[model samples]
Target: MKRPTPADACEVSTMGKMEKVPTGIPGFDEAIGGGFTPGTVVLVAGNPGSGKTTFAAKFVYEGAKRFGEPGVYISLHEPREEFYMYMKDLGMDFRELEERRVFKYIELLPPLGTESIDVLADKLVKAVVSLNAKRVVIDSITPFIRELGEAKARTLIRNVLKTISKGLGAVTLLIAELPYGAQVIGLGIEEFMVDAVVVLYQRRGKAWTIPVRYLEIRKMRGRPVEQVVYQFVIGPPEGFTVLNPVPLEVRANVDYRELLKTYISELDEVLGGGLYRGSVTLLQGHVGTGKTLLSLIIAAENAMRGKKVLYISFEEPTEQLQQTLETLSYPVDKLRPYLQILFVDPKSITPSAIVSKFVRRDTLPDLVIFDGISSIRRVIGRELYVHTIRDLCKILKAYGITTIFTTDEKPGKDPAVSAIADNIIWLRFRKVKRGLVRTLMVLKNKLRWSDPIEYLLYFSDRKLHLRKLEV
Candidate 1:
């Protein structure tokens, strides 16, 4: 679809408001002013695998399942059995809804002639009337538009789709397919005929490998669309979920003098007592500089003190991390209750998805150890990486959660993160006559002046120890 312009904004303001029907997609209804306006034809257009079918199906399923609204799904292509199975995998069991008599699925074979358009429209109207459906989906209108040409297609939409919407008072989602690399939504005529238009896009990142999905509300007749674009994901349990990156407005009334101790005495001493409450800390270092271990020690120690700690690891799995804790003589069993380890694959998930999940949580953790943020940076690219980190830090600090983000980058490399950080700890390896020795230094401290001296770091008897480094 085309980007909305000034003229489009003016058009939206003049339209009168109507009753809204929620689509049941998470984080989506709120984006579109509580949901789709009733008695309107909405065009859901996208390239193949961009989730047009999923979006339409969800609109129908949710109406039937949650709102007790009867719905009808008319498919010009995909068979009934295949559609049922595919939707079932996404946790939408159309069969069950069909059995309840609240849902109807109709499949029509194509090579649809000019005469067949009337017949198809008649069947759709009959289905809606029979079921007294409140929602309808035509998946899709592309074949009809291509076969019948623009003039005939326009007549079909205006005569049938709009008639069903206005007369029957059902919200209709007309699915349309845009060929790969094509920008226009369904030959251009369908867009004007529809009341609203939503475009789904599967865009590649900077590496051009991972696919990032986005949903853009190109046109909404009655409602004022504040944010046009949103990142979304489609999976099981819930069909489609929008990941809203809008930072929450939270005021954390915290005393800078109050400290959250890590219980590592030497490290605490170096930290000017302990980490300031509601402050963000960045631990930067090269690979194998003991960044992970140090962050884990802080997480585990705080958890042992009955504080909830969320350890988000992008690189390491839970079992591997538990083993490391055991190797360090940490009580893994004892730490399990208070320490919640979440392992996320950077490739499969988008940064917005991760942040959205955190935003939905009922209770925020006392401490969050985000291990290996560099992996996320690599997958999402630099621009998105910076944006996601900035938003995440803002949310965490707003909740007054002391967060520690570990990355495999040297100090001053990522000024964006460093600027957001309240404290920066640089860890590195010093190669001397005795071989490589691990060392730690406080690069920046917002609450107090950082000590200039570097310190030797080592582990003994399952505890980390630190001392002044002497040449």
Candidate 2:
């Protein structure tokens, strides 16, 4: 073949510099600015069982299968047959790939005495060139270094990288084994020779809880990595995949901002014109003090306004709530279209169940009323109840859904619910000459410009009367 001229050589180098060698692992390529640079040597360093081999295999397999670039996988410890069967188990189908001449698996054992390191390096380069391979993976170089000493091993690796970069121009992955507690990476010197270094580690989370697999890009030549540490999982049928980072803010997909009316003028007036969208209101009162009644009234009024409402009852059964609404003269027939009633036995409900139902509902509601959180707090332990209530409020608020939670007041107030609630309303009944007199008190209102005060609560002729504002 005739040697190319200076202009042709410049064009070729420019093209090679512009292109990237993408790894098939999801989120990995994006972390390294689309992929590895062409003709670059990448060192994947990890402890035993840290998914080093699986990652290298997936990298080459994806190149062959998706990018139409042939690859060679050279192993020193893993046998050729075992490597084939193992990759097959992971759905790589390396046998078929080999048959199609897209993949080549080679195993070279240690004690390479008779043959010189330069000769072996030449043989590997020839294999890549002969097969027209564009990608290569060696799992790994530790055993080879053990057989050829550090100095000779370093020289041999430099020659191999030169052969691939200058002769074949193939992107290569060199796996390096590090001891469990080794401070240095991959014989310590290879880091300087390679263009990139990635470490797979088992990182313990939250007070040394069980470890999770994580990938850290320690160095990437000429590329900037946004997130250094990324969570990854190695499972069969997909091989190795890097997981995306968790979202910083949980945003609602549908952005609804209008407040659903509670239909109580004075109550709504004290609540900054109306209850704000995505606000959680806690209704606390003793038995017969109208906590449940207030929740039902809000739900009924919101539903009557053509807004979808989900009413969850822990105390009253669905039939009993319907009958009570009928006795209270609420238009149950008109409200049925816009309301969904779910009667859950508090003992049978768990935090997970409530979160799933609220987050994954088929028809998401504009407003939700959890009538009788006291029962939930009692059934689920206090700690679990607090956690679940907090999570539920977060999900509801994130989804822009107005929430009403009713709980019976105890002698000493529990700050658990109030801490997460955006609005707090307290109901109390005082005995007087005219039977029992009910009063409503506003303890907290997160809405802008809302007056927090107490008022006499009187209900008659399907309307609520807030009279004699005090305190």
> Model 2, range 255-357, lDDT digits (tens) per residue?
2346567889878777766777778888888888888778888888788789899999988899888887888787788788898888987665445446656
* TM-score, per-candidate, Cα-based: 0.86, 0.55
- Which candidate achieves the best TM-score against the true structure? 1
| lDDT tens per residue, model 1, 1-471 | 111111110111212555677788878776786677778899999988999999999889988988888999999889999999999999999999999999999988774589878778788888999999999999888888889998888888998789878898899999989888897977788889899999998987665345789999988996678655788988877778776656466454344867899888998998889998779999999999999999989998898899989999999999999888888778999988899988988887777777766664666677898999999888878888998988888777766778899999889988988998989988999987799999999989888987667999988878998999875
Clashes of 1: 0
> Which segments of model 2 are wrong by more than 4 Å?
1-17, 88-91, 114-119, 204-210, 246-254, 257-471
What TM-score does model 1 achieve against the real structure?
0.86
Q: What is the lDDT of residue 392 in candidate 1?
A: 84
Q: Which whole-number lDDT from 0 to 100 does residue 47 have in model 1?
A: 82
Alpha-carbon deviation at 318 in model 2, angstroms: 25
Please tell me which predicted candidate would have the highest lDDT against the true structure: 1
Model-by-model lDDT, in order? 0.84, 0.75
